[model samples]
Target chain A: MKRILAADIGGTTCKLGVFTPDLELLDKWEIPTDTTDEGSRILEDIHQSFKSKGDDHELNLAGVIGIGLGVPGPVDFNNGILNGAINLNWMEQKPIVSEFESISGIRTIVDNDANVAALGEQFKGAGSGHKDVVMVTLGTGVGGGVVSNSMLIHGHGGAAGEIGHLYVDYNRRFQCNCGKKGCLETVASATGMKNLAVHYYESGMTDTLLKNGIEAGTLSAKSIVEAGEKDDALALKVIDEVAHYIAVALSSLSAVTNPKYFILGGGVSRAGRMLTDRIEAYYRPITFPPAYENTEIVMAELGNDAGIYGAARLVKQFLA
Target chain B: MKRILAADIGGTTCKLGVFTPDLELLDKWEIPTDTTDEGSRILEDIHQSFKSKGDDHELNLAGVIGIGLGVPGPVDFNNGILNGAINLNWMEQKPIVSEFESISGIRTIVDNDANVAALGEQFKGAGSGHKDVVMVTLGTGVGGGVVSNSMLIHGHGGAAGEIGHLYVDYNRRFQCNCGKKGCLETVASATGMKNLAVHYYESGMTDTLLKNGIEAGTLSAKSIVEAGEKDDALALKVIDEVAHYIAVALSSLSAVTNPKYFILGGGVSRAGRMLTDRIEAYYRPITFPPAYENTEIVMAELGNDAGIYGAARLVKQFLA
Candidate 1:
């Protein structure tokens, strides 16, 4: 029974999963991320957990094949180095794989978390059976991962899937956190939705549920999506506007990569088919004809577990 | 020494070249495109030209290896099929590889001209020594080609490099020829520059050299570039505006593919560093910081010979 250890490292927590080579999860847990001391304790903590699997989960590590980690920033996958991961408080490049492999006596692999999530989706979620998939995560800020021909496109400097930074509107006066004006992240993320609702409310529009929510200080992307689902005009308008930006960005992406499926995930995607259906409606017309006919947009299935699964996939690929 | 035949098929003319395995051009010539019969005579003319190469240039075909073609449309590269090349009167999918291979008794390969041109640039032009390159041609219309890991990204339907159709301006009222509004092609092409000049002139900003050319019906993208070179304010404004659009589109592209270099080519690129330098100026601020720092924008060096050279490279790759 060959097994693998996988970790999805984030700013707040590190999710650890034990999986069989067949991709079946045997155990999963999380630990608070220790960002103090330049995150020096992170790898040691993971190694300790791996060694204590017998005590923690009644599972032995004697059959472990390797470890795969998904980190929240650019990664030099070829060298298993983490490059400038702000969330981890590591400004300098860190040799991630060697550190873990030295402790565990096993091979290790690391990749950007977004890219890992995309690979997870391609492997077992909404993008299953597709050789090419583009996954967009509409969270606090948008993140993306691209898999073409069943392989991740790491691009030069490992910056290939930075989808949220795409400039979507030249007219936007507000600057995105990335120091650009009108990035897709400013219009398509959960924060963007709230801002859009506020912008509409501030523009002298009244007599809408969203305005009422704003007046009550209860305005949120979830509330707006809930209202839009009920056919509220203002909420629907905000959703339509957000969908337009996302669809336009996806269309532009389609023209360049032409992936077979676009998997929408993250906190915002929990709005489910309401968001996907609207995005699809806007996507078809803007995409090039040939690509429009072939590419399909769908919601991700694995939810919060995608990252760990993707990390496991990374190890699986290494084994293969 | 073994040699190869390469053809770059265009609407008006088909350029043919003979190249040694090392990619040196042995001979080159062009013939008018006979697109009168669904482009049926096009291949025959190419074959006749190839057969007569010995008499015209003293180049014997006894050592010919293969033929590589660059066509003006989407191609199913695996099967060498051309899909709806409007410029070539090829509305039906044509099995170009087998057709040419059967006639010449040699292996044949086919790909979109833009993709081939990108490969050509990667092999010997400005993109030389780079494994990842994105080439944008601002001809009458914008055409693009992408190379990642030294392989052309054909996408799902071989329409991957359709960068021209990316919607850049949501406020645009005029539709592009692709039946979309605000496509990058609507602002980045030679025709797009002329249209921008007309748009500015129509907006009542008179007293410029471009206005005089427009009044004389001689306004062209080249004339606009020339005027900008002379520091004509309105022409510079138009050039700046066009450069802004190109920069934004390239920024969006960088966020996704993050190629090492962007190779700008075609008739509009004849403006040389004047255009590329301005585009880089605008691009740096909009692109993601890491990608902006690593990626460069440069001009293609092969000029009209790029397509033919790229075609020859295709055969060389096949041989390798």
Candidate 2:
């Protein structure tokens, strides 16, 4: 059995796991990440942790296949290099797979976490047997991964699934962090939700936020969504507006990509089908007719571990 | 050398070409179509033409590798059935390839003309040798084709690459025949351009069309664009509005597909670089950075002949 050491490297924490070929999770661990400067130190910590585990089980001495990693932000999957991951504040021409292989004495494969997670969802999660699937991870920013004909759709420069940056309106103007205006991210992402709330507060729809001093500083998107769940009048108003834009994005995506399965993931997707239901409610009636009946929308099933599982799958595909 | 008979069925005319394995244009013929009854008679006409040609050549004609057809509508490429073609009035299902083969005694493959044209552009036209490409055809209604990783991306049931029907605004309540509102097709196609001009005229735009009595429904999209080229005020306003929506569709498609080549085709694309340049001007600013820098947007080279070229290529691939 080929064993893979899969790791998902986020900004604040790094999660790792040892898994068999069949995705049998044998062992798991996590460590606080020092992502700001000297990121290679994290590699040393992982090696030390492996050595400690090796002394206990002699698993490495027995032999293992390889390692896999899923990094945040844009990645050059074909090259296994750190292309440009904003969440990790990493800007490296570093050969990630080569570095990891040098440290662990095993082959390694790496890809963007969103793409890895999408593969995991397709292989063992909500996507199941579906071949064409699009997974949208809603976090601070919107992250997307597209799988078509049983292959991940990472286009030239690994920009294929960057649906977050798509613009809903070309005639109007609004600022986006990717140095664009009127991007779907400007209205449909977590930051976009906050932006909408700010707009609402400005428009005097703040009976709830005014009562709770959320006025002076930026509020977490989670807090705002939670408030809406509790029927906060202002939060509900902002969410409705955001939901419509989300529907527009989804409808547009469906028209272009036409994936059979549209899976929603990450912390924000835990808002469950409520947001998705609203999104579909608005999406179905507005898009071309066939899409309304055919496409399936569901919340992700694998949760946080999807990245690790997908990373392992990449390791198997690349290393084998 | 494997030879394939490639056919492109348009609204007003049908074009036929016999191509060699190397995509050499061996022979060509054209015939005006009679679409009084859902286009079944057109297929019979094509089959009879092939039979007469075969008899004249004194050939046994059993091993005609494959026949590839390019239909003028949103076709379910996987199923080889068509839907949503307004001019043809084909509301019901028709087995285009099978019916043709049954009559002509040739194995056949069929896809929407736009999808085939994308293949033509990618394999033999402007986007030749590009692994990632998206092609748009701007005729009666807008149509699109997607090629990724050197493979045509036809989703389950062949519902992929239907970009024209995408909605940019959920709140937009404009009437589309598909019962949708504010679809990209509503503003991005030749018909859409004419519609925008009418909207402009109705909303009291400066008069130039009134001088030609175009308000009486005599103005074609081509006529309006011609007027715009002469610096006519109302035509430029309507064309610019149409260009903005085309940019919206392009930005959204680019974000998800991240194609290396974006090629524009169809009858309206004859407006040439005028429409393409304007689209790029609008999309360049709004596009997500890094992507905009990498992706190339250009006019399609194949034009009306793209479908036949694409048909030959697709059929050749199947034989290969």
Per-candidate iRMS values, in order, are 1.2, 1.4
- CA-only RMSD, every prediction: 3.4, 3.3
Q: Write the per-residue lDDT of candidate 2 for residues A1-320, one digit (tens) a residue.
A: 44677888888888888887677788888877776575757766766676677644446724667778888867777788877666566665667878877877878888888998998898778888878888888877788788887778887767888878877644344577887777777777777777777777777776785335466675877887788889888777767766777777778777777778888886666776557778878878777766546788888998888888888877777775
Q: Give the per-residue lDDT of model 2 (tens digit) for B1-320.
A: 35678889888888888776577777778877778876658888877776566643332346467878888766776666776566666667777767777787888888887788889889889888778899887887778889887678887557678878877534463566667778877777877777777777777784774346464667788888788899889888877777777877778888888888888876777877677788888888777776667888778887778889888888887753
Candidate 2 off by > 4 Å: A18-28, A31-37, A43-67, A86-89, A101-107, A169-174, A315-319, B22-25, B31-64, B82-91, B96-106, B169-173
Residue A198 of model 2 has an lDDT of 78
The residue pairs that clash in candidate 2, if any, are none
**Residue A40 local lDDT, model 1:** 86
Model 1 regions more than 4 Å off:
A1-5, A17-32, A51-66, A206-219, A230-234, A315-319, B1-5, B17-33, B44-66, B212-218, B316-319
TM-score of chain B of 2: 0.87
The window of 10 residues in a row where model 1 chain A has the poorest summed lDDT is A53-62
Worst 10 residues of 1 chain B by lDDT: B54-63
Error of 2 at B120 (Å): 0.9
lDDT per residue (tens digit) for residues B80-172 in model 1: 899878999989989999998787777789999998999989878998887888999999999989887777887766778898988776666
